[model samples]
Target chain A: MIQKGMSVIVKTVTKITLGFILLYAVYISLNGHTGPGGGFAGGVIVALSFVHIMLVFGKEMALKRLRSYVLRGLTCAGALIFLYAATVKFSGGCVPFGAFLEKSVSCRLFNSEITLPFCEMLIIGAGLFAIFVALVLLSKSDRYDSE
Target chain B: MIEIHLILLFMIAAAIVAVEARDLLSSVVAIGSVGIGLSLAFLILKAPDLAIMQLVVEIMSLVILVRATMRQDLPFSMSGRWVFNTFSTVLFMCVFLGAAYIALKNIPLGGGDFGIASGVYLREAIPATGAKNVVAAITSNYRLMDTLGEVAAIFTAVVGVMAIARRVGRPR
Candidate 1:
């Protein structure tokens, strides 16, 4: 209907804001242990940033930047990391879901407890991005076939 | 408490406007405002985590909704009036700034004390998980298996979307 993307103003604004959105997402992810946000919240913001890119630059441009396969792989990798962390202790006779590593002092970056949120951040962000790309591409194909 | 009530009331009013508005685009924007109000309410309630999530989720959904509805209203004549549009946009901006001013001016401090169950979690969280954020401790340590399950669920959903969307549906 309208074009591949919006007007010039939207594009310029998006370019300026994209980096801040991404920076905020990472901040939220890293600070999950120290403050208010967690992995899921961070992941959602990450996905939204990608959505913003797609909306302003067109789907083809977005796909060019990050292909669908990469997103899928990232999602799977996040899940695997979480699974390994959860089950790795079973081989040593420790409880399956217990802490995977020694819990360090609070507010530290290397705390083992951050793994779950980190993995969650990866899985939700990449998975949601993949889903959105799929749906958008699907609708495009639908329009072409019907025409 | 009063601040929370006022934000809630504002949210309710915006929701009513969203439902009753004649223009689909304005309605969608109104609904977005309601979400912003709800996020502000969360902030007042001292749940910064929820507030951040709500604000981002609201933004993402609003973008998607606007994209979906924009095509349907392209031919509408009411949107063509530049003067009225300018006036409405200015008014909206003024109202938004006013609300933001009030919200910023009245933001309360941290939520009072932990409740009974929360009291125990607050005490035990650091010792158990060595994490300062109690919510993060519960999610990533105390209830980690659930987080695993959630990840699995998200993975399954993405796979399903990929599987279903790959089909071209064109007549062969």
Candidate 2:
């Protein structure tokens, strides 16, 4: 019975709100340089958006949106992105993980430091989503075996 | 100042409700409110970054916790030693309150000095990182190594969870 998902009203609401949530997450992450929000916070919101779908529409439906392999790949890609920022040495930089990109005007969307938060946002969002999916699948299988 | 105190009072009330509620779902919801209250408190304290992170983390935690409780028939059982438990709880609360009082006694309630580091960050963050948000500049640029380690830690944790879940739940 739980496999079928929630009521129609809830599903409908989720359908309408999911896109907005994802967009908000992206905005928050990108605007980290300009405001209070950052990659970690944005990534958490992204994970919650997916979790919202899972709660209303069941694990299978959520997994269909973001497949397990894709989630894994995303997590890896996020880590690699951060590593690339850390390792790549631009000429004339003293520090290893120093700002390689040129700094433009303050409070703008594009900046040198944006890459770090962007990578963090991807890593956190995809990693957490993967963990949630694994745990949900595990619980399902446990219940299945017992039944 | 008064508003912050009121919000804190609300948080305390919500925490007590979370602990004492009989219904599992009610307890979860109560705790969730406590998290929201904390986020609000952060915003009031002028730390919007912390508030945003707190709010999103609270929502994600609520979702995961509610999912764990759903379809589970296990009741929240208490230890048989109710008297001891009560005594311990009261004692711990007293200790915590005492520590909190001692900790906060030296610090002013609101709008005090941000110290040398904060002053430097506030002054130079924009010039150095060209980011308007001091917190973002500090985390993403100044503390790049720290953020890298954090991301690495999370990646490792997710891999561990996947491994454990697969091992335990896989059908033979």
Candidate 3:
């Protein structure tokens, strides 16, 4: 089993800042359609936040919290979500993509005039997080065996 | 403009340092700095969306690099073939860069070719998609196929990583 986390100071700081990091990631993902950030950016942020948990709390802790299957599911789900959102004709075939939402002037009530959903960002973030975690876990196992 | 120039020079220096660093960790850190500098340059150039993406990508990649390289005390291997490989790579890079420079120097930048497309996007974006941010609109609305394709590619790569890692790590 992989043991040994970092020092107390590092752990304390990670505990404090980890939640904020995740929250910020969510904000970025949700606001992607209307702001400077987007699905790619938010997804990466979310992955990094999980990585931070691993760095501070040890791999075992991180792995226990999240397993490989979950990530695999997430990655596939994210792609599926994107496919559904992108390929769908939207709202009973009112229009197709690349000009799909161009005619709708009334969606401003919810997204400040932004029509993009949060699903894409969430999936991208989840998939990326899972991939990073998988790689880290793999490397850790390699190190353990070598030792 | 001068600030951008200074940042670009610093980025170049950082790239050199990253390439030349003795240790893996230092090299990773240096590369991360280069990413940060590039993001700042993007911000200054009025591409805030790109800047944000750059910042997140840099940090995540840095994390991955640090994680991947932390285990071994990897010295710069002085194998005989290493020197030859390095020399050839440098030569190839120089020739490619020279060609690129010649081509870039002759091309007039502002020919107003794609402006019409961008103009249509700007005018129709808010009306159609409700995206206040034009960049966001372009991503999810204007050119969704590109985004879908890119995301699919990344997902495939990640799945591959998961599979390889699992195969390597499992106990026989």
Best by DockQ: 2
TM-score of each: 0.72, 0.81, 0.83
Q: After the best TM-score superposition of candidate 2, give how far the Cα of residue A80 lies from its true spot, in angstroms.
A: 2.2
Residue A126, model 2: Cα distance from true site in angstroms = 1.2
What is the number of backbone collisions in each predicted candidate, taken in the order shown? 0, 0, 5
Q: Tell me how large the interface RMSD of candidate 2 is.
A: 1.5
Clashes of 2: 0
Task: Give one digit per residue, the lDDT tens place, for model 2 in B1-172.
Answer: 9989999999999999998987888989999999999999999999999999999899888887777534455655676989998999999999999999998897754446747667788889889877898887887777767877888888899899878875355678
Q: Candidate 2 regions off by >4 Å?
A: A1-3, A8-13, A89-112, A140-142, A145-147, B82-114, B167-172
Rank all candidate structures by their TM-score, best first, as comma-separated numbers.
Answer: 3, 2, 1
* Candidate 2, DockQ score (0 to 1): 0.65
User: For residues B1-172, what per-residue lDDT tens digits would candidate 3 score against the true structure?
Assistant: 8999999999999999999887777888889999999999999999999999999888888877877546564455756888789899999999999999999887655446567777788789888977778887887767776777777787777777667766455678
Give the residue spans of candidate 1 off by over 4 A.
A6-17, A89-113, A140-147, B68-116, B166-172
Can you write out model 3's per-residue Cα lDDT over A46-134, one digit (the tens) per residue?
88888878777886787788876776676676666556555552342233442645434322322322223455555666777776766
Docking quality (DockQ) of candidate 1: 0.49
